[model samples]
Target: MPEAHGTDEVSDARPGPIRVVIADDHALYRQGMAIVVELDGAAVVVGQAGNGGEVVDLCARLHPDVVLMDVRMPVVGGIEATSRLHAADPRIRILMLTMSDDESDLFEAIKAGASGYLLKDLPGEEVADAIRRVHDGQAIIPPGMAATLLQEFSRLSQAGSVPEGPEPTTLTDREVEVLRHVARGMVNREVADALGIAENTVKNHVRSILEKLHLHSRVEAAVYAHQQRLVPPDA
Candidate 1:
């Protein structure tokens, strides 16, 4: 199962509270989670679900901005649900909220299409912050997990599983700079600040990068950046 954790802050340049849906088999826990999300004031709960199927139904119906999903549920599991939801709507962010910290779960969650994974024991404040960060297009991986993820990417690269994308020549000089920061796990605002550009400009660059590269989320862009050596491996 997934749980909550922290990510870098997003630029407040984006307006409005992020829309969310909470999914968990336990009614009380689900309700409590809804309360926490609402109390945080950064997100509004648009729906709730008790299983993976219900989550897909709610997401299709409501088109929420994010889904706070738990991994363990009857009928379907969070990983499957996340994969389904992501395939259906890549724009909808999915954050896994469960108690499992097993590396295998983490690896599967990423493969299953989760934008981020968190332990259920994450602090309420950090959870709220992570919602905003994920909504703002940042990939949320715990500090320690990042190394493991990177190592996995290396293994995949060695196995020749990573796709050979467009040549780096396709990106503008500015976009290359932005990708460097993004691959470093910097939020849009951070990229903007690093490149001394406006936040919206950074967003534009990100969009262009995704379009030119045919990638979906910032997480994919980050991984692609590494695999393509857009940024130095040691960095």
Candidate 2:
């Protein structure tokens, strides 16, 4: 039973900062991370947990906008926790912030429905900015790891595990337009610029696309679009 200690007493649903829940096995690291994430006021740590079950329980109650989850934790582990949380609510964004560079962990995190996978060696400011991007529906995978993900995708394709038709989707033309850009790894700002729409409008479209497709993150959306052959053949 992890406790939500040393955090602001803000309401669970707020308009100010992005509500966040930090879950890691280490208390010192979790506390230090909370400080860094809240330093610029772009995000707030509404709760803290040390294990998967605790974070699951906290997310159930706190309903944080984003979860900064670790890959490996005792009791429940991060992958299982992410799967459970994503199953429960695809709207809550989850980011894997860990020291593990294992490609399998990266694939599992994304497969378990995490919105983003990031390493711990990044600067604190960049980490904080990642929270913002994840909150705004962008997938943040480091460059080196992006290639790892591509390799994984290629492996899956070579294994003949990828379905030719995948599953049926009900995305509209505009949503298809947006999904293609997302699958191409375009952020919301870029998508908005390409489509000649407001950035916030692109955000709304992304939210709608996620909700309609029952997808969690832009990464998942990207995968979905690829399976549907929505992007260019080169993509």
TM-score of each candidate? 0.80, 0.75
lDDT of residue 98 for candidate 2: 70
TM-score of 1: 0.80
Per-residue C-alpha lDDT of model 2 across residues 1-235, encoded as one tens digit per residue: 1111110011123367899999999999999999999999888899999999999999999898999999999999999999999899777888897775554788878788777676777678788877876675566677556656755764675577644432535767787898888778777788899999998787777877777776656656666676676765468
Ten contiguous residues minimizing lDDT sum, candidate 1: 5-14
List the candidate 2 regions with Cα displacement exceeding 4 Å: 1-14, 100-102, 157-182, 186-212, 229-234
Error of 2 at 199 (Å): 6.6
